[model samples]
Target: MTGDTMRGAARAVLVGPWSARTWQACAHLLAGFPLGLLTCFTVVLLGGVTTGLLVTFAPALVTLAALLWCVRGYTALQRDRFATLLGVVIDPPAHCREEPGRVRRLLAEAAEPGTWRQFCYHLLAGPLGVVGFVVTTVLWTVSTMCALVSCYAWALPADSAFGRHLHTPSMVIELTVGGLLVFHLAPFVTVGLAAADTWLARTLLGPTDIDRLRSQLVSVTQSRNAVLAAADAERSRIERDLHDGTQQRLTALAINLGIARQTLPDLSGPAREVIEQAHEETKQVIAELRGFVRGLHPAVLSDRGLDAALSGVVARSPVRVRLSVDVSERPSPTVESVAYFVVSEALTNISKHAEVGAAEVTVARNGATLRLVIADAGRGGADEGGGTGLRGLTHRVASVGGSFRCDSPVGGGTTIEVELPCES
Candidate 1:
């Protein structure tokens, strides 16, 4: 009511025992003992009953499953409590898979390591909870009582111990000092116990180190795949722009030039020669643009599929290319793009460096893997470190978690084999 008292109260609320965290710590300690006791009793009774009934296999299985699930439910409750009170979030392990049959589902739940971890949590919580509760309750109660005892001692019955012991001011002051020490110490004690509880809960209820690492790895893999998909999509867009926009314009320009050279035969000799030179350059530019667009990403690869696309690639190759594609199901677009590039680059290398007149290309799918084998019976001194595109192919294959192997002996024929995942 007084200004000083109000100011003291405000200070305490701001940074003392009256703060929310202190109260939460107190609440956590207060509840831990009962929860621990109940957990211990439940585990003991359930384990005992389940063990005794093990002779009956069916009954034992059901009981064991029930026990694991019961512990799991308790663990969930503890997780909720920690999150609500101290803002600590724990990630539970994701190890259980539901089965069609009830029995199988129960088996999966029981067999999971997380189930046993929850059970162990209950085991440890028992003793820790009881001790925490006892310490917290005794310190808070006794300290407050002693610190305020002087105000109440006179009201006690005359023959009572407090009334008979003189209850002097000196004794009152001494007890008040000692009690105040404990009163202040109580919050620290509660905080320490709460910290211990948090550690136990997080360790038992949350994911293991391996699980966290696996989660991070999965997240990174997903992000990397997303980037690859985006890049592939962008390449397709660029290819489309070239094929639809720039390539179309260039084609029209070349045609117009060709028409002018053919139709304008009455032009002067110098003008006719200029028209002829421009027509030839226009044709050459269109051809180069076509090659550039195809190198970026081919429309056939997206419109049809890898099979149709590879066939077109082999058909265009100057060196005799024997192409065999056996893809039953279409792979993902990103994967198809990578495959197209791999085949196209390999063929280009063969024509440029292999000094071969013939090359063999075979593509097949085995389960979820796409296999490609390109071989040439020419001089076979292919080096990935060499200026050939083998190094680039290796990196591209690895980007999609695929493997690229090149086997080329100096005198033997060159063989390039690649295996890519069919993410579809």
Candidate 2:
């Protein structure tokens, strides 16, 4: 439709008949003749037999399934044919293979619109192929003969009807001009036919709009999961680096400072004051670093599992937490991590704004769900909108196909509940 494209196409049309693309189109049409005819036979013959056999219970179902699968396979070959001959690739529709039972899978596949679309395409191909093959072949044969009449005309008997029809120089000139015109026009015709076939192939063979959207959704979900997993892994790695490298070095510095203070007893008063201050600051810094690294990702969680990990968390909380973990089996690492963060964040919130000194935390696994409940009898009206840090916990829970709820009424205690997929 663009001016530049129109001009380019006009140019191609004027001098494009001898190009390889034109010949490829011709060959494609010729090859499709046989392929399309075979498909037509498959639809008419196999389909009719399957329909008649429908009254018979088991045999009919089996035959129908086989027919559908054969049609699918045959459609794949047609797709490859066009791809190979005309350099056009048409992808097949997406088919879910998740059904566990054989008969159920067959029923599901049969119910899919993709199967019927392909069958319809098979019905139309034979007629389309016949037209393309006949038209292209006729143009090629007749045009070539007319263009070369001057060379082959001498071989015709002068007295024969065919020779007499084109014996004149004017006729030869006219026929040759017509032949040249037809030769130039043949590419457009073949291209037009091939374009029709391309449209049909894509419409029937390619995934439907719903299927395409579903595939996109699946891809986005997978990408989100990957990003979440990568982030968790990176956090764990940083935690390890801080614990093994930076924390160890800081601890050594604190120990050295402590040793320096006690080992030399003959230092000046000003010097001793500076050393004591430095030693105190170093110890404080070391304590903060240990908490920071533990908060990043706990090593004990990975070693002793969720129950012991939650116990450690409770031991460190400023607000006393009555902890109960009923999970007989540990959930996945991602789910466990989410559960830990949820409880930790809730407890931190209670410590900061709850005006209460005690809370109850429960972690339990019921079937495929890992559930966590954190309850406090503090002054209420607590929610994510109040900047209680529950929003991040909600997102974290959802990232693993889990749920989070905050139930905090005015004058009623806050109860935070979370559920995570154990498999995830």
Task: Give lDDT tens digits, candidate 1, residues 1-424.
Answer: 9999999865653364566788898888777788888888888789889999989989898788778877877888788878887888888765676788988888788778877788888888789888888998898999998778777877745454655453567766887888777787677778888998898887888888987898898788889899999999999899889889998998998899889999987999999999899889988988999888888889888889988888888888989999999999898888888999999999999999999899999999999999999999989999988899899999999998999999999979899999999982
In candidate 1, how many Å is residue 379 off? Answer: 2.8
Alpha-carbon runs more than 4 Å astray in model 2 = 1-13, 47-65, 101-111, 142-183, 249-283, 322-331, 360-377, 380-387, 394-424
Candidate 2 per-residue lDDT over residues 207-266, each given as its tens digit: 888888989988987787788778889989999998899889988888898898999789
lDDT of 2 at 235: 88
Over 4 Å off in model 1, which ranges? 1-20, 37-72, 95-109, 152-177
Clashes of each: 0, 0
Q: For this target, which candidate reaches the highest TM-score against the unseen true structure?
A: 1
Per-prediction TM-score, please? 0.82, 0.77
The per-residue C-alpha lDDT of model 1 at residue 129 equals 84
